[model samples]
Target: MDKLKGKGKEAVGKLTGDRRKESEGKADQAKATAKDKVDEVGDRAKGVTDSLRNDDK
Candidate 1:
């Protein structure tokens, strides 16, 4: 996952003292978290829609 990769990148960045890499890794982790939240919302929406359809029968 992006988060895992980001953690590795961050560790490497710290070891090498590359601020840019550390920042990039943090960004990647944030982006991955946001994407996961969106997916969770979409899944919840789909479940609601399915429940509504069943009620109509």
Candidate 2:
């Protein structure tokens, strides 16, 4: 969601020739990508824990 919004901002910035806006949009995209990676790692960790518990049974 945030990634998409950031992409839109980037496109709009490019269309309007706003360097500041483009930089901001790029920053937003980078932040969002980092967040997504964190979330993915967390989810995989949770899955591993669940699998380990199930195997103990």
Candidate number of the best lDDT:
1
lDDT of 2 by residue, 1-57 (tens): 888888888988999999888878898999999999999999999999999999999
Number of colliding residue pairs in each model:
0, 0
Q: Which TM-score value belongs to model 2?
A: 0.88
User: What stretches of model 1 exceed 4 Å from their correct place?
Assistant: none
- lDDT (tens digit, per residue) of candidate 1 on 1-57: 999998888888899999999888888899899999999999999999999999999
Q: Candidate 2 — worst ten consecutive residues by lDDT sum?
A: 19-28
Task: For residue 45, give model 1's deviation from the true position in Å.
Answer: 0.3
Against the true structure, what is each candidate's TM-score?
A: 0.96, 0.88
Please report the TM-score between candidate 1 and the true structure: 0.96
